[model samples]
Every structure is written in structure tokens, then in C-alpha cells.
Target: MNRKEANQPSPISRRLFFSYAGTSALTATLVLSGCKDDESGMPVDMGVDLGSGDIGVLNYAYALEQLEAAFYTQVIQTKYSGITAEEEQILTDLRDHEVAHRDFFKAALGSAAIANLEVDFSKVDFTNRTSVLSTAKTFEDLGVSAYNGAGQLLTDPNLLLIAGKIVSVEARHAAAIRSLINPKSADFSGDDVVDTNGLDGQMLPDKVLMLASPFVKTKINASNLPTP
Candidate 1:
């Protein structure tokens, strides 16, 4: 294959995709009830209500995965100027992983899944490496924190296990992006994100959504999510 062809992003295998989908289907069957505004008993007219309980948490994750998948897809499609082969390969892998994750959550939520979110990446400059990587770092960090914070809200052990697995992957992605931004440095697990107790930072849903709002055009109503 030519260099250009070799650098092209590869699709995730059907076997792997189906494996995740199957797991998601089982989880959905076990956890979800009908999608409804549990608090108001009426559909949310202002925006998407992320439901309540475990279903709400799953939808929240699905939303973030959608954003990440879309961002990396755009980056790969319109690669930044001066992107090296290594960078291209890294980004391609990230894109594939995020897409898999996004679809996995969608499959898990089934009928309870939130509608496809409309994103606004207008602030991101795809042509600039710094702009892309910086945004990537922000997203990866936020994803890790989001899962960590939401974990306590999940009552089901199976769901908690799944969330744990996904958060570990998100943490890895955050580290990779951090390394890219500050190669061969301790910034990969910087004190900013990792505290004195050596634990990764966690953010509640409200704070996470607020920070993520700029990139998502869909007004998310996360009011019904369980509190700590």
C-alpha cells in the first residue's frame, strides 16, 4: 500500500463491534424502563432529558462519546498541516475507538437512547495541530472525570463494571493526548488532573456538561441525573 493509503483510518472489525453491541443489549434489557421524564412525568420540551437513574448515566456517556467520535472523525478527514505519520495513526485509532464507544452506548440505551446530538465545533480549527490536540486533551480529560463521578450513581454492579472498563480506556486516551502535547514529560499524569492522593480528578455531571456545552449544540437537560 502507498504511504497515503497506509495512513488512512481503518474501520473497526465487525466482530468487535458486535461483541460490544451484544453486551450493550444485555445491559439495556437488564436496566432500562421506558424513556420518560421521570421527574415531571412529561416529555421535556426545552431540550433532551437524560432520563433518570442508570439510563440517565448511560445517555450522558453516549452524548460524550458522540462528541468525541465526531471530533476525531473530522480531524482525520481534514488532517492538520504538518501532521506526521505517527500522529495520523494515533488520531485514526482514537477516532475508531470513539466511534465504537459511541455506538456501544447507543446500542445499550436502545429505545431509551437520546437523539443524535447536534455539535458546534466552530471554535476548533482543524487545520492547526495545536488547536486540535488541545481540544483533544480537554475532551479526554473530561470523559475520564465524567465516568469517575457518575460511577457512584449507578446502583447495578454490572453497569458499574462496564463503566469502570470504559473509564480506564478514557484515562488512557487522556494520557496519550497529554504525551503528544508534552512529549517525554510528567505531564501525562500531571498534578493538575491527578491529586496528591494519586487519584484522578472527577467531576459531577452538571460541571462536566457546563464545560462541554460550547461544543454541543443540543441543549441537554441533565437535571434528573442522580446526585451523590
Candidate 2:
């Protein structure tokens, strides 16, 4: 399942890159801090439940997109201190990209997409720079791994290509954020996350959901993943 056409994106800049990274880090901090505290939530509505099999996998990706979209939205709304012009711009771009991904999945899933996911990140400290950047690094890294691991399981080349393109960007985000934190901690793409054949590792959907469970309130059923 894939879409046929889309708008084109404008060129990006070096300064813009840095700006996006800082702003994104700032946003992750906010979510990690407040999402956990906000008890207000809407009733689960719209789309299809992630049935077992391939449908479950799509729902898994959608769930992740929801979390990411929420995180970026909060970051842009309440930015961290010491943010520069370049950082602001790039963060804006990333926010837009995440929003696009979220909406794309929502549209594609039609009746198969799961309900709105509630996220809680109350344990994080937004004021602290390290915590924000580190958390961002984790999300980016996990996203890359998730896409990589899920690739082979995807039989549709179109879907595979879509996942592949997105994961590369996720890896880029991971690298940029990791540099901010330590200038050298972007190695989350290790053998563990990458299988023995030097291919991107594939984590079962259940395991991926478990890693994401801290933020999402609902449990996922991956019993539907196709048996290879």
C-alpha cells in the first residue's frame, strides 16, 4: 500500500540542518517532561484497528508516527533556551516532515489505522539540555532500527522503498542529534540493531511496541505479522 503523487520539497541548508536538530532536541525534552503529566485525552476515534498480519505492521508504524508528530508539535510550541535562527528553521522543517508522515499514514490506512495514541513523557527534564538531546537520539535511533528491521518483512517494494527512504532520514536525524550530545555518539546503528549479514536488523513488532509502550497507553497485537 502506497500513494501515487506528492508535492516537492525545497532545498535545505547547513545552518538549517543545525537549527532543526536543536529545536527537535528541545521538543523531545518538552514531551518527555509533560506528556507524562497531561492526563487530558480524547476518546479513541477514527481509522481501522491494526488487525493481525500486515495490517498490524502498518498500524505499528502509524503509532510511531503519532508519537513523533506529538513530540515535534510540542517542541515547536515550547522551545528550549539557547536556540538559534538556524536551529529554529530546521526544527520547523522536521516538524513539518513528521506531520506529513503522520497524515500520510492516517490517509493511507483509511479504515485500518488505529485510534489516536496517548503519550506520557513526564519523567524527562526539558530544562536540561543533555536530557533533551539524549532522548531525541534514542527516538531517532529507534526509528531507524524499526524501519530497518521491518524492511525485509515488507513484501511490497513500494512500501519497502517508502520505509527505506524514511529510515535514512531518521538515521540522519539520529546522527545530527547525537553530535549535539557528544559529537560522537551516533553509533546506535551497531550490529545489534543491524543483523549478522550486515543488513538492517528486524525487530518483531511486539518488541518494537514494548519499547514504545512507555509512551503509549495501549498494547499492540502483532500476532498478524506474516510468517516468512
Candidate 3:
């Protein structure tokens, strides 16, 4: 059956995490939020659809890239306490890279691109190093997982190649953040995230959205995105 047809209206306080196989080898554990219908029991606007098929996948990437860019931009703006010059420079570079990524997706999607999302950083404490680095780590890891999970959903070879390129960069970002948290060791490829076969973590759009929504003021309706 079409997975989209299986979606049901959700309550404001209720959410779902679905672990299911997609069109190919990649598996997804989606974090679905918001109600599918209104009081009239009719289909309500679920915000941005992210479309369907390959275009939906690109918009998905674009949304996360935008979040990462916004996050790094804020980090650079405040500069956590006792941050070294090297750390500052590296973070600035990360910020630039995220912006480039965000813009790349925006350009690639063109008219099909979703609108610029507003971020909610109210929960983040920018004054503390530990807090900032932890958040960065979370975001990077999420990015890597998101790309991995969404990969097989894209039927377009060129789009998949582009995704491959972006996922590599995201993995690097994840490693860098992990290194910062543990300077003496290479926990970047730790067993917790990477499998024994040497695969990075993967997450469905719903799962990613749950982790990311706290930082984003905008409500995202990702239910309309294509499933495997």
C-alpha cells in the first residue's frame, strides 16, 4: 500500500516514530507531529509538504542545511566563553560551509524550494561552551543520519550523487564536533553511532524533525514527503 495513505491525523500532544523500510535498502524512523485534519475532519494545512519524489528529498536536505546554517551563524555571533582562536576559526569555517550548503539547495530547488524557515534557539544557551558544542554535535549527527536515510528515496542518479557529496561533508562536521567533545580520542567513528560494518547512523524525516523542531519556530509538515 502507499505509505502516504497510511498516515492519520495526530493530536497536538501526540507524536509517532515509524521504523519502516523505504523504496530501497535505507530504513526510516520518522518523527511525525501535528494533526492531519482539523475540527471539521477535513485535511488541514500541514505547513510545507516537501513535495513528493526526488524534489521532496531535495527540499528535505535544504531544510536541514538551513537549520545548520542558522545554528552556526548564531554560534559565531556570540562566541562562547574561553573559546580559542583556533576553535573560533574552525567554527567560522563551519558556518560558511553550512551557508554554502543551504544556498546550494536553495538554488538547486529553485521555484520548488520551500520558504526560509524561522529558527527557535530559545532553549540553547550560547554563553556556555559545553552547551554550544553539544548542540553542534547533535545537529551534525542529525544531518548525517538524515542524508543517509533519505538517500534511497531519490530515484534521480544526479540528485543521489549530490546527496552523497553533502552527506560526506556532514559526516566530517559530525567528526569535528565529536573530536571537540573528546580531544584525546577518535570517538568520531565510535560504535554508538557507526556500525561494526562501518556505517554511520541513519534517521527518518520524522525522527529528525522531532530533534530539530525545538530549535525551529516554524512548524514543518513533512508527512507529504515520499516514502520508500
RMSD of every prediction: 5.2, 11.9, 12.1
lDDT of 2 by residue, 128-173 (tens): 5566666676677778777767776765555666677677887767
What are the Cα lDDT values of the candidates?
A: 0.82, 0.59, 0.76
User: Using TM-score as the measure, which candidate wins?
Assistant: 1
Candidate 3 local lDDT, residue 15: 15
Q: Write the per-residue lDDT of candidate 3 for residues 1-228, one digit (tens) a residue.
A: 121111122221011111111223222223333347778899865676676667678788889988998898899889999999878877877887787677766655556778889898888899899999999998998899999999878886666777787789988988888898898997988888899898887988889999898988878888777777
RMSD of 2: 11.9
Q: Model 3 Cα displacement at 7 (Å)?
A: 37
Error of 1 at 166 (Å): 0.7
Model 1: per-residue Cα lDDT over 1-228, one tens digit each: 222232233244334444443444334422222344658687645578787878788888989999999999899989999999989988887887788788777756667888889999999999999999999999999999999999998877777877888899899899999999999899999998999999999999999999999999988888778899
Clashes of each: 0, 17, 5
lDDT of 1: 0.82
Higher-scoring candidate on TM-score, 2 or 3: 3
Angstrom error at residue 18, model 3: 34
Error of 1 at 134 (Å): 0.3
